[model samples]
Target: MSSATIRCYIGIGSNLDVPLEQVKQALLELRELPESTLIQHSSLYLSAPVGPQDQPDFVNAVAEINTHLEAHALLDELQALEQRHRRVRVQHWGPRTLDLDLLIYGNESIQTERLQVPHPFMTERNFVVYPLAEIAPDFIFPDKTPLSDYLANCPMGKLKQIQI
Candidate 1:
């Protein structure tokens, strides 16, 4: 684990088993992560499933945190939280009880067998980008692109913010 704390953003989504409550619970759990503090989070948003529309709509949000844990350790913690929520991976872009994606890690770009920071597809997904823009409107990607750039090109489509 790194002693230095870094600001990070996590994308949260769920389309199964009371998705609204699932996202809310995950936000609370994010606050409890070891070596990390949840700084802020975006309002819950409702969005259509990214793939396989046969599933239910998803509830999504973005969380900002400062963490002393290195990127992979933080990823571990997020995955553990998902397991506690009973997330399963049986199909590609399948419905899940909870989905936690590490969107950015302090302006660092990371790519490895197990993790990717500034998640590759975030720029193309309104469910991820819109909620993220809500919490960190001025954020810049590791690649030096402004969040606004993606916002300008990514249509909201069916995304809608909902009060929980």
Candidate 2:
């Protein structure tokens, strides 16, 4: 039997000093994950912080990666990369030099103390939905809803797509 390929989406953001540069580096590192291929990247976007409004807004975007690794293994690799980049999870929605969140893993729905698939607020956050739609316009949620349709009804954030 051939190995199964899993498609995973990653939401990347940075809000502290030199965020753009940090985000760029993070993307390069993500491309290095084993058994993975960086499929496509959404244009970079700048958006206001989600919760606890005191922090700086983040530079956000989404990327689609094809991997042979299982969902939990991908999560572990992402967390390892975050730690390597000095991501400190001290507070909820805190500012960071880089944040990498696993947004989706194939059609898998996972819930555990450490992770959740399709993310918890993917449809609600323009930062996540917009960029994800940019790269994977036809991607469907577990509920069989098209991403573009979901984005049409979500609250819009201040989004600026950076020209590469």
Clashing residue pairs in all predictions, respectively, total 0, 0
> Candidate 1, which segments miss by more than 4 Å at Cα?
none
Q: Candidate 2 regions off by >4 Å?
A: none
- Report residue 6 deviation for candidate 1 (angstroms): 0.5
Instruction: Give me the overall lDDT of model 1.
Output: 0.94
lDDT (0 to 1) per candidate? 0.94, 0.86
Write candidate 1's Cα lDDT for 1-164 as tens digits: 89898999999999999999999999999999999999999999999998898999999999999999999999999999999999999999999999999989997889899998889999999998899899899998888999999999999998999965
How does residue 139 of candidate 1 score in lDDT? 90
Our tally of clashes for model 1 stands at 0
> Model 2 reaches what TM-score against the true structure?
0.94
